[model samples]
Target: MTDNSTTTSSVDLNESRAPLLGAVAGLGAVLGVIAVALRFYTRVVIVGKVFHSDYCILAALVSVVAFTICNGIGIGYGFGRHGAAVTPEEITAQLKTTIGVIFFYHLSHLLIKSSILLQYIRICVLPVEKRICYVVLALVIAEGFTWIVVLFLTCIPFSAMWDPGLPGAKCIDNTAGFYACAATIISADVAILVIPPFLLRHSSIPWYQKLLLGMVLALGGAATIASIFRIRVIYMATKGTDPAWDAAPNGLLALIEVDLGLICSCVATLMPLFRRWHPGIWPRRLRHRGGNRLETVSDLNCVCSESKSTASEDRGGKTDVGDAVGSGTKLGPEQ
Candidate 1:
């Protein structure tokens, strides 16, 4: 708990926090909105239909709204600022802000991970990969639910979390919770990021389009990197010294990680707009790398999660689908 008596150092910390927290969180929210907007347009307008993954994205977007609102409140309450600057009466308010941030942080990750899982359902084709994906999804759900429960119940009598001296109050070490959640996020993100590259390995699509899909899928890794940084900040925050100051970075990183996850997931589904912008955007030499080549490129709307064919059927149509990949682009595969 922070001392009631404040120091000049506390004021300095408090002054720096507001702008830094707002700027980082605002940037994340903006980037997330832009990416998700593109994804929605790509699905509803360009593809003319939505899939399971789109629904997931929608749900994640709702949580993002909640997360952003909580972020504003938290920062307003001196969340990332020094706790000593908070008056005794304001302590409860600051603590409530912390609760809001934690609650929404968990929700954002849960929804974003679910979105990625649903995206995997639409795009992953192999039986082995499908099995792996299913297991990962189950774990993600379990982990997310666990964290939700843990965060909500972390301090008994709930208010004890903020008012540390409350009688009969007990709180769990938050570092454990942070570690568990970070592990879940990193593993799931890595799996989703690696999946597309693995799926296209033997794809009948030309190497040019194959490379493009690979690049798109790789975008999910940005979230994974953000998660790592969030974990580092979490470790520091859980150290129990000047927590309010520490929490600034912790909360900021959480917002960025979840927002980045949402953004990356949405971007992975925006191939339609990319292909639409340039109908003839295929590269040559890379097209020669894949030994066997197809006459048609699959501008698969499913790349945007807009396909009628199951991922399995597309296995046979790999060549045609690859050819159809762009709105109106065709590159001759080297003979």
Candidate 2:
């Protein structure tokens, strides 16, 4: 009876958790789609198709699509698990797919950061400022790539990571891997968030424009918050050495955070164009007065005033001439 009760409780717990994870991942996927659509609309319509080396908005779009697919898969797997028991092989496949999804999740951020850095380069007119920005971009790219390498290859001999089902494979310290991932991700998120605001503040654009850009750029910080949330969830979820308990959620959350961040980064890149070109076809107010009529009326008034002034002066009275120059003065300068 005791064993049966324990089995029932375990099944119930898994059943409950699966749907919740599915819902979260599903909502993220939907939001990703909307963000991507907004990005493309801004790029093609507002910003124009002209390729500016500095403004590569397409990176964001690609990121959003990648995220959507990843989250969609998660949602499917999560809900599937809730509905029925999946084999260890199925679960392992799911875990491996998740790992791949998250790998691209971080990769997408690189594209976005590059797009934003390029935008900064686009509006920067000064040689010194441009050179400094380029240098900073180079450093950021190097760091991001380094971080990616560390993230993927941290355990060394990649087979060990997902080879738990295979008794023959040896893996590294799980705790060390977890902490390393958490630390590097947090550091990278902070680094990416830091560079943009500094770059934007000193950028050559007008102060108001820069402020607008800064607000848009701050969207990337939202991903940082997501990263922090994922870290917290992972810390809470994966306590035992079993590894699978913590690894699955951690991978999923990482995907969610980075995917959202990339989408936001792309959206921020398109913000300048959106500001310039409003999405709606807002109707302009029609004035009763035409441009030519306004000019014609002014011309007629000038001619009439000239004739009146000449006749008043011809009367040859100094008082009449003074009165004409004062109250009924000509609309235009005297010839």
Candidate 3:
């Protein structure tokens, strides 16, 4: 009777949480799609010129969608159920799905970071700022590839990751590896978050616009916070015996982090759309009141243009009065 009672309690305690995972994944996928779609629309229609960053973001969105779909498949294979409640076959299937999930998750983040850095490189005029972005971009790319390689190499005879009893199979300490990856990601997130504020400080935009731009970029903090929470969840999941159940939060948080990153990256570019739909909505100071129209230059483009003009003036060159009136000149070749 005691044994039976314990089994009942175990089953009750480990009731499937797949519904929660499904809901979060579904919501994140939908939001990601919408955000990317709006970003493309803004760039292609409103701006009339798509950029390399736009293409990179679109690729990130595709990866995010694939990640969400893989999570859903894993859920169907008892991913959110306690290991004790899941059959061996179900666990194997979920493990197989997990490989894809991890791949797409990392791929999405890599593309997103690259997209943001490319945009920064495109708009930043200062040599120091551009150099910083390039350094960070290199780190992000290196970290992404390193994690991906480590993922595939986690288990020798990689199938042993799921079938741990396979003869002579070996696997690294994946929990420690995950921690290292998370740390790298957090570091990169901090760098991405800090770069914009530093650049903005040196920009020639009005103080109010700087504040607004800072606030928009500040949304990246949401993804950073999500990464921190994900690390916490990883630690918690490692402590639990029922990895299939405990790890659900890790997947959910991963989706949230990727989706948040993609959304935040796209929001600043959507400014042109907002202005087009509601021109008078901007503050009088932000909008052109006299012959000095702000035009429809993107926030980053405006900063780039003004920075170049400032640099030109600082060099004691004759500055065109029209340049200050939002001429919307292309800074250089699109990076």
Q: Write the per-residue lDDT of candidate 2 for residues 1-335, one digit (tens) a residue.
A: 11111232355435434455556566765666676666556556644443442234355555546755665565555523422354556555666565656566656666665665555454443465467657766765775577567656644456555565455565555456556666665665565566545644432223444355456655655677767777655543345333333344665566567657656755554543443465222111111234221112112113224244344333432111111111122223343
Ranking by TM-score: 3, 1, 2
lDDT of each: 0.66, 0.49, 0.73
What's the TM-score of every candidate structure? 0.81, 0.62, 0.83
lDDT of 3 at 157: 95
Predicted candidate 1 versus true structure: per-residue lDDT over 25-113, tens digit per residue: 78888888888888778777876767776777788888887888888877776676676776666657777777777777777777787
Better of 2 and 3 by lDDT: 3
Worst 10 residues of 3 by lDDT: 318-327
* Candidate number with greatest TM-score: 3
Name model 1 segments beyond 4 Å from true: 1-14, 206-211, 282-286, 289-293, 299-335
Off by over 4 Å in 3: 1-9, 284-335
Error of 3 at 307 (Å): 9.6
